[model samples]
Every structure is written in structure tokens, then in C-alpha cells.
Target chain A: MKNYFSSQFKLGILGGGQLGKMMLYDTRKYDIQTYVLDPSNEAPSKVACNHFTQGSLMDYETVLNFGRKVDVLTFEIESVNIDALETLEKEGIKVYPQPSVLRNIQDKGVQKDFYKKHNIPTASYEKYAFAKAVKESPQWLDNLPFIWKSCTGGYDGKGVSVVRTASDLDTLPEVPCIAEKMIPFKNELAVIVARNVSGEVKTYPVVEMEFHPEANQVEYVICPARIDETVAQKARDIAEKVSNAFGHVGLLAVEMFQTENDEILVNEVAPRPHNSGHYSIEGSFTNQFEQHLRAILDLPLGNTDSKVASVMVNLVGDEGYTGPVKYENIEHIMGMDGVTPHIYGKKETRPFRKMGHVTIVDHNIEKARTVAEKVKGSIKVIAQ
Target chain B: MKNYFSSQFKLGILGGGQLGKMMLYDTRKYDIQTYVLDPSNEAPSKVACNHFTQGSLMDYETVLNFGRKVDVLTFEIESVNIDALETLEKEGIKVYPQPSVLRNIQDKGVQKDFYKKHNIPTASYEKYAFAKAVKESPQWLDNLPFIWKSCTGGYDGKGVSVVRTASDLDTLPEVPCIAEKMIPFKNELAVIVARNVSGEVKTYPVVEMEFHPEANQVEYVICPARIDETVAQKARDIAEKVSNAFGHVGLLAVEMFQTENDEILVNEVAPRPHNSGHYSIEGSFTNQFEQHLRAILDLPLGNTDSKVASVMVNLVGDEGYTGPVKYENIEHIMGMDGVTPHIYGKKETRPFRKMGHVTIVDHNIEKARTVAEKVKGSIKVIAQ
Candidate 1:
């Protein structure tokens, strides 16, 4: 085995967000040298890595130049330049999750096709160059109440809309997009699957995503989703199948919709550490970020079992509060047992902005959920 | 409570050792800005903090200058300049474990006297101006096999020696020192007491320090020391007494010797995170480093209860190896259940140097110990 600890071995990370910051906890543990690149100099990962380069991840030349200086390159965000990763791979540098997987999943048009080809369970969707073209489709009009999603640059409900009529389509942005038959699902669940370079695989327990009633944003993520054991097993199995099909090295967070009749259908997947797995930091035997590093390096995977049942509450910026961030009553919540809040180093607070997250772990999932609600209610991410 | 997260609030740490690096994990979690100072630019904490300043922690001006830029000041090492801490305290920099506590425990003779004055139990000892004077004294000469420790500047068994004969004293430096009667103890145990500025106190479970027979260095730190419940209670009570007596504001690692008759005698104390408490990182509800930061910040102290039994094995550099460090077969140990290695980020290795540590955790202490032995046997720190 190659010596990666306390040596000249360099691990390059393509994004310097909180995911990369969390990964550094494990990298620093092994004393592995790291070079991180992100578009912002104020990125959360800037301080924890050996080298921090501020550059566009989508700019081919910038990514290629950064990738050339490191031995093994991986990314926290999948939006990075796949062409640069391909060049790095050709030059004998290791690119985890392989650039082809990112390219296949980068566009919803292509990703949906790949899923269909692999016999993956997903909602049937129609692609369009513009919202008017999608509206003009007679077949899509017949299938009313479809989900209109921008093919690219969509995150956290920003580029998604539940279109109920032709007028909803009229207000939609003129961007390349996909219109999918909206499923009246019973629940939105997620499973995190880890695949190493050596093809070893492990999956975390299924998690139930509780969304805000009005905003439709994930408010709480409860692990060991309060679903049937068989359904949980099926979710995990499908997640593993998805990971195997992609042949992605590192973590693949599979988001799925659990239909009213209990059929699990894939919604999407992120090829890096995902928000849904944040509870792993306090609940599981190994956290998602650490697991990603282990998988990327092809190290023996750790036990994916949960040491304790856990719940995660996202700390988004309070509505109508947009300035320097302040986590009010954070100490009151911290006084509770097993409550850990992760402040994402983002200094500002804007309505609906991702500020941080809180993990509450307990031997009893119900008790953890109870505390999570208390945590969600007690702290306010406001402008001080 | 003061909002230290993502603001101008700065926490200044005087030493840049592994302890500070571990503390940064919690600080970074809260997005609290920190300034770390160390003599070496290659200190383990350099990469993890917002600011890194190269300066002598022992130099009054250097420490004061660094302390002036932060809202709160703390140190990982106890050998820092006490006078500088005093100045910082007077200036309201909120130095934890106040400089008076450091001054009282700065000298071995003074520490022993404080213990005696406070009615704290300890072994009988004598203080000498020099090693020759210790040997020349008739009464000290009568007491052979006493432990000779330099009154000041002793660390990691370097300034300590077991004086059995006149020849043993010949090689010692002529410095102010102390001679203590060596007592046969059943076990060497430690209890880390965390006290907040609010005067709240909590003690961790007793840990047994297993030493290398030849090197006299701690090889394994086993938490929840295999001892009687009453004895464990006594150890914790005494540790609390020590913390209260010194009015310490952060973690005070109180090392003790358990006599054959189950008598607990104080050996020494460190005012910051201690090696014996390293197992808490994996075993306890809240790790020692995080607890230290919470205590200093006057935040409610976290639970000190054990989540799992754990054993920490130090990864000291193997004898006759002195170059870039390498952990041979690290992957082999990573494959084991509940094993985590913390590399100190020191690139070079020499015999008996503390390069890193591996923690083995299990629900059962016996199982953890068995796995710890396997971990200790499988991995070796060597020069490349």
C-alpha cells in the first residue's frame, strides 16, 4: 500500500465548501497534504488545507492547472469541469468518482437517459430547450401537475416548480429544462451509498426527509426512517444498485420518493458528501466526509452502522433577516444533551440561506427527534 | 452568552501542538475565528486556524503582542510565559486557568507545597537547589530510589530521572529539582476535571495509563479504568478538589497513583488537555478538546459520560528511526472496527517521539482492549 500519511502525498479537493471542511477533519488526522480550490477566497475550507487556491471549478484551464499539482483529485461539488478531470486522468493522476460519471449526471437530460438505460427506477421526464416548448407539448399538458426543473444550475428549489397549469409554465425561466410527471409520493427518503475505487460498497440506513410545509425545504432528516423494515431494505438495495451502475468512487447520496403504495423511485443523486448525511458526523461509526475520503483513497470501508439513532435539523437564515448571522439561543439548545450545531462559516444571514446544521443523536430515535424539534424551535439564525 | 461564531470574536491559543489542532475541530464547527502562535511555522495547528503567528510562547512580549489581538486567550502547553498570561488577564483578555494557577503549579516544589497546604494527599518529597546538593544531603542520600524531577521546565519524562545511586545523579543537569519517595502503586490513573468560568465542574471517568516497561512512556490509555466503583468515585472527588483548589477555568488533568490499599495520591497536574484524556475523543459523549473549548468559553460543559469504552495507544516513533514518518500498515488497522488514528502532523520522526495515537472503542472494555492490542501490534511508526 502507498504511504499517504505524513508523506508528500497530495490530495486535491475541487470545492471548498463545508463538505470539504468536514473532510479535512479526517485528512488532518492522517496528516495528509491537501490542496483545495474554490471560487471564493472566503470558502470554509480555506484554513484547514495545506494550500488554498481561489479559482472557478468550471473553468477548464483553472481546474487543469490545479489538478496538475496534486496526486489524487476529488471534488466536493459535481459542477466542476469534467474535461479537466479527463485530462488529469489521462495524465495518470487519479480522479475519484471518475469524470465520466460526473459528465453523465451533469445534465438532467443525459442523467435521465442514463437512468432509463440502466433500468433504474425514476419518474418519466420530458426534456425541453425552453419553458414555452415544454408548455407547447400536448402530451405534457395531458399529464398535468408535472414538476418543471431547470436542466442545469438548479439547487434547493431555486430552479424547480410544481406546475399545475399552462400559466405556471408561462412564468418559468427560459432555460434548458425537464418536465417530469409529478408523483403524489407518501414520503421523500434518502440513502447514502459509499463506493470505493476497489468497488467495495456500503450504504447508510435510509433517512426520512421532513420538509417545510410552505417552503418545501428539508427541515429535519431522521435516520432509520420510520418506515417498514422491508421498505428500508428496498431503499438501500436500490441505492446500492444506483451506485453500482454509476460506478462512482466516493459517496453517492441517492434521493428517492417513496410512493403511497411503497414503491421507491429515484429523484436524483449527488456524487459527493450531501446534506442528508450530516447526522453521520455524530451518529454513525464513520461520517460521510470521512467515508468519502476512505472510498476515494480505496481504503477499507468503515462500518456504516449507526452507533446511535440520530436526527439532523438544518439552520437556515430566518426570514426577513439578512446581514451578519447570529445564532440566537444557540447556548440554550447546546445545553441539551447530544445537540451539536455546525455553523458553516458563512458570515451573513439571508432568508432561506444555508447557514449550518444541527445533529441530535440518541439511543432512541423518538427522543432524538423530540430534541431536534426543540433545537429547531429554540435557535433563530438572525442578523445581529 | 457572547456570540463568538462568525464574527470579529477571536480566540488566541498560545501553543500549536496536536491539542490545539484537535480543539480547532470544535472551533471550526462553530466557525469561531482563532489565532494560534507557535515558535515553529511547521506546528500541527498552523493549517487549521484563521491566523498563524510565529513567536515564542515563553517570550513575554511575543505572547502579549499575540494576546492583544484576541478576545480570549488560552494555551495547549503549560510551559508558556506566565507573566505574559498575567498581563493579558489584567488587560481583560479572559485567559483561562488564570496565570496565578500556572504560577502556583509552575514549580514542582511550589506545587507540592500547595498540595500539602490544601491538605491534599501526596507522597513525601524534598526539594533541592541542584542535583549535587540533592546527592550531598545526608537525609536525601539515605533515601535511595527516590524520583528526581527538575523543579521547573520538566516535560514528557525528559527532565526527570530515577535516582538510585550517586552515579545516576552525575549525568543530571545542575538545576533546581525535587526528590520524592517512590511509592509502589497498583495503577497510575488520571481524571480530567473541566471547570467553566461560571464555576461549573465535571470530571471524566478515570483512565489507567499503561507505560512501556523500558521507556517509561505511556503506551496505552484505558478509560473507565478497571477499578472498584468506590475507588473510581474517590479518584473523581479528589480531581474535583484539585480543580476547585486551583480555581482552574478549563481542563485540569490530575494524574494520581493508586496505592495497594486503594489510597489515591496526587502525582501532578496539567492545566490543559492531557494525554490520558485522549481516549475521550472516541469514547466520551463529548471529546476532551471540545470540552476544553466549551469550558474556556464559559459555555455549558458537555456530558463527560462514556458513550463507549475506549483505549488510546500512542504512536511514538520506533527506536533507531529518525526521518520522515510513516505509519506502516495503517490501512490494515483502519480495517478494524472502531479504530481511529490521529496523526500529529509532525513530518519528522525520532525514537520515542509522539507522532500520533490510535483509539480503539467498543461497547465493552475488554473487547476494546483486545482490539487495542491488535491495533498496537499491527501498526508501526517508522522512518521512510
Candidate 2:
């Protein structure tokens, strides 16, 4: 009962990226005042937020100063200075998805260790102090085809690689890292769990991430993951358990893999709105951004059911294009039924850059998938 | 072809009210830069747009200056300076729902005349230069009860009244006005027609406005009106005809009356997004705001079909409350399934002031309606 809607309540968001931009839409809907911090002056959220500060999110003083100005604080990205968040928390500023939870999740090594401590099912992994340790250990040759992930600073497709050969270990960065046994998976699935300060919790329907046949990238995110009901239910249960373990407020998107034998193993989790839930903007009764707001505000959460099945395709910069962004054939995709493209307002696009996303929705999941394919094939993010 | 997305192209909007605020959401989604001008610095759209100017929308110089700064110009409210818009259009600034179309719809007398000229079905009405003309003519007494509407500068139930008694005529404002024969109607319906600059047109499903039995005010707006399919089709056809008659580029929300004989009579039309279509945000495949952007930009029009049944209840300020606004029991409504409230960000409350709106969407129309009633009965927009 803080009168958060259309009142003087200030919500400060760290890292004004695409996620923060989308979150601003909901804040605007509720007429809540918002301030955003990002290093770039042209951050996607700069225009939408009530105030925009250009500063490094990783700078302790910058983060602390921004946190002090708001009634409640949250972050769209995990790379923010956690020590500042702890200081703000000590001063009674409400920081959702608490700093402790972020501290645990910010490093892959700590996150994996937390999962093991909580008895959460995950791919077996070994934490290494540095990539040199794995290179020097001849015994590591036994676990040849493992996944090498930089313990910190890994994002998108960066800082992660598959070590199938001895030379692959040489290519690893000199940072704290983890090598996990690669579990063959049938499908990559995800569940977005929302938990409020009052302990109210809900999970969105399991979504399946369909990978490109040859590109080895996520091609489509289909809601209600064309999987067995039992598997989907198990995913939701596990996601809720993860939420409880973190005691985190706001949204937690838990990514997992469905093993060939049908075992569900957690891949990782983002304690904020994930790209996988971008489809919810048009697909769910309550979009993930709005749900995150509800969770952080401790208001009653909206229904998580989808009005129609949805499929989302990320619009990345086309290869060999690296200048002012141009969305080619965008109008062609716009003509397709139930297609909505969300441009992230990034003026420039480089190869594989996360430029935007398009969502296709229909009553029939198959029809939605078909239209999503057309949308994916037609629209290309290129240089002007 | 203009590369509006994340480009140099700018969209200018007059009257930064709730409609403009909602439209801003779509503009943000598309990363389309926008400039907004409103008389009040606290306009809901001020924070969201790329640039905001506090200036009178009806002032010729103010509107012209703002319009000159952008490639295209539009308005959320109809009372903007049309002469300025005409000048901008002549200067090659695309003004959507065209300045000419807005000119016709801006005045009640001219709008009614255009309907007659275009052979559109509408209520029989007589235009008078002044209220004194109707008062001095005793023969008007024979007409008895009728609807009195001011020819210009009327909005949100203001400047419109039911003239049933002699004193009611005295209460009328001394201005250009219209007297329409009251036609007993079964339901007041609306159809939102979207027409792009290229002349591509589409219509949303008819929505029925259910009024409060005693208050005689619209209480709920239900989509896919619970009427015969033939009647609904007629309403849509008439709306399209109205859109075609104006050759309007953008959204024209045609409000109609489904008469006792199932005839559809055009009551009026809004050349921009209207309150009746607010439910589309949660119900339709593409909401009206996004559709308006597509039409104005001349991009392909989106699907207008509803994904689920929806009922919208306007959250007007409670009687006898006129200070800082507080939404009582809003949390109760938020707890309801499929309920989403959109606060307009107006800080003050006056009797019957439109503070916000709540939309309830469900797979079943009846269930949505039931939830809408619960939402209406629970939330009260009042002063703290």
C-alpha cells in the first residue's frame, strides 16, 4: 500500500539495456517514476525513463549514488556493483532480488555451487581458478568434450565455448572458469518464476528454445514447449524451488535442458526478465516486465496464462553488416498475421548483435510457429 | 522505406494525454523517435517521448513549430489547431487521420453534415448557430426530449446533455450546437477502423458499451458484442464506410447505436485511439495503439482480431473526492484473474474524472464479464 502508481515513488533501475527499456514500458503504464543508469548516453531506456544517468554500472560510487535516489532499486543486468547494493540495503533501500542472491548468481562458479548445496539438479561441473589450471592438468583430457564457461563476465554467446580438442583449452580466457560435462539434451527449455516480497510465487508455462540446425543458435522461443505435460510440470516445480532457494523478489528465469532420457537438468538462471520471456508481451495475459514490476512492488501478481500461443525470434545483425542498423524486409514480416517486431532502439548493429525480437501469436501453436518461421526468414537486421 | 525505426525520422504528436501515452508504448516498441507537445508539463506522455514541449496544442504557432520539427504529425485529441496541421501537410509533413478528416470530425455540426453528404446512416439532427435560436423558437418544444451537443470543443461527456425540460435548454452553453432526435437503442456499439495512407483498411470486432442502469453512464465495454452476428457485421461495415468516406490515414473509432430494428446509426467518430478500444491491449492480437502507428507510418496493418474475450471498465474518480488520487482496493482487483489496470498518471481526482481503466480478459466472454463486474465493484478511484 505504498501508492506506487502515479505517485512519488521512485524506482531506480540499473543497466539501461533492452531489458530496462522494456521494463520502462510497464513503469510508464503504471505512471511510476523511474531513473535509469547506463554507461551509454544512447542507452535504449534513456528516453522512456524519467531520468537517465550516464555512468558505469560497475562503478561502486555511481551505483551507490543512483541507488540512494530511489525508493526501490533493481537491476536489469547482473554485472552491477554488488557492494554498493549491500551498502544501499544496509541503509534500508529496497533492492529486489537481493544483493546476496545476485552475489551468488553473478559468478558461474558460485551459482553452480549454490545449486549443488541446495540439491538442485544440474549438469555436473568442476570449478577452476583459471583456464591455465585446466590447460596444465593432463587429467582434464579425460573430460574432452566439456563446456568451458568463464566464471564471471560471460554474456550472450561470449565467454563460453566447447572444448572438444586440446587446442580448444588454449583458446579459453585467463579467468576464473568452470568445465561442465556436456549432457546431450533433447530440448532446451526455460521457466520464468515470479516471487514477491510477500512470498507469493508463480511460474510461467515452460518454453522450448528451438536451435538453428546449423548455426547453433536459438532460432525460436515457443511457449508451452511442445513437451510432455509431466516434463513441463516438473520444470515449473524445479523453477519454483530455485526461486525459494534464492529467496529472491522479482523475476527469475531458469533455463534447463531436457536430457534424452527425459531428465531435467538446470542450465542456469537469470534473476531478471530473460530474452526467453519476450514472447509474453503479446502472448501472456501478464507480460514478464509487468510481472516483474508487480513482484518488486509486492502487489498481487497478474495471471500467467497465455491468451494465445506465441513464438519469438530474435533479430540479430546479419553477418558482414556493421554500421547504422536497417531492418530489411521488416514491412514484409509486419504484413504477416500476428507478427510484432520490437526494435530495441540500437542505432548500430554488428554481427550477432541483439538488435530486437519479433513475436508471433495465434490460437494454434503450430500456426504461430509457421508464422514465426516466416518472420524469422523475412526480416534481416543489416547495415544502412 | 523511411527507416523510421531508430532513424532520423521523427513523429510529432499534439495533445499528450492518456491516448498519446498509450501510443508512446508502441512507438517505443518500434524504436520510432517521437516529439510530443502538450499544454501541461505533467502530460502522461511527457516522460516517454524523445522530446516534449509544453505549449498549447490549439495555438497555431505552437502547434506549427512543433509539427515543423518532425517528419510526420498526429494528434491524440481532436481539438488541436487544424489550420496549423493543414500548413504542415502542405509543407510535406504527413499528418495522419488527415487534417481534413480531423476538421470534419472536430465540429459536431460539420461531422453530421458530412455523414449526410456521404450517405452514411446517422441519427436525424438539426444544427443551430446558437442555443438562443432553439430557445426562442417555441416550435422546438414539440420536439420534447432530444440530445443536445455543442458543435465544438466538447470532450469526455462535457458539452453534451439530454434536453428533457425547458430549463435544460437554459442550462445549455451559448454556442454552435446540434439537436438530435433521441433514438431508442438496444446497445451502443463501436468499431475501430484502421486505414493506412495507402488505403489499406481493416475493422476490429464490434464492442458493446453496457451502461449503468441508474447512473446512465457507460460501465463496461465488452468486445465481440453479445449480439447477432448479422448486427455485428452491419456495425463493422458502417464503420468501414465511415473510414472510407473520410479517406482517413490512421485509426477512426466509429461509435454507433444498434437501434431497435437492428439498424446501425453512426453516433460519432474519433479520428484517433479512443477509450472504447482500451481492452485491445490485453484482448486483441494487435492493440489499437500499435495499429494506429502502422496506419500512420503506412506500414502493413496488424491483425485486429481478439485473442480472447475482453471487458473494460473505466476507473473514474469517485463522487465527492477531489484531491490527491488514491485507488482503493486496486490490489483486490489485481488479485483477480485476467485483470489489469492502467493508471493514467493523473495526480488529482475530481468527480467522474477518468483516472484509469481496468481490462478483464478470459477465454470465455461470460467469465470476463463476470470478472469485469467484480473489478468495477471493488476498485474506487478516490482522494486520499
All candidates: CA RMSD in angstroms?
1.7, 1.5
Model 1 lDDT per residue over A93-208, tens place = 99998998998888888899889999999998988999989867888888888899888887777788988888888999999999998998998999999988888899999999
Query: In order of the candidates, what TM-score does chain B achieve?
Result: 0.98, 0.97
For residues B1-384, write the lDDT of model 1, one tens digit per residue.
Answer: 679889899999999998998888889998999999999999999999999999998999999999999998999998899998898899888998789999988899999999999999999888889888876677767877888899998888778888888788888999998888898999999999999889889999999999987677899999899999999999999999988899999999999999999999999999999899888876777888888988999888888888778899999999999998889999999899988888999989999999999998877889889989999899988988
TM-score of each: 0.97, 0.98
For every model in order, the TM-score on chain A comes to 0.98, 0.98
Locate the minimum summed-lDDT window of 10 residues in model 2 chain A: A210-219
The CA lDDT of each predicted structure is 0.90, 0.91
lDDT of 2 by residue, B18-132 (tens): 9999999999999999999999988988889989999998899999999999998889999889999999999988899789998899999999999999999999888998776
Q: Which residue pairs of candidate 2 clash?
A: none
DockQ of each: 0.73, 0.85
Clash count for each candidate, listed in order shown: 0, 0
Tens digits of per-residue lDDT, candidate 2, A1-384, equal: 668887889999998999999999899888899999999999999999999999999999999999999999999999999999999999999999899999889999999999999999999888899876887766566878878999999888678888998787777788999988899999999999999989999999999998655345677999989999999999999999988999999999999999999999999999999999999999999999999999999999888989899999999888899999999999999999999999999999998889999999999999999998888878889999
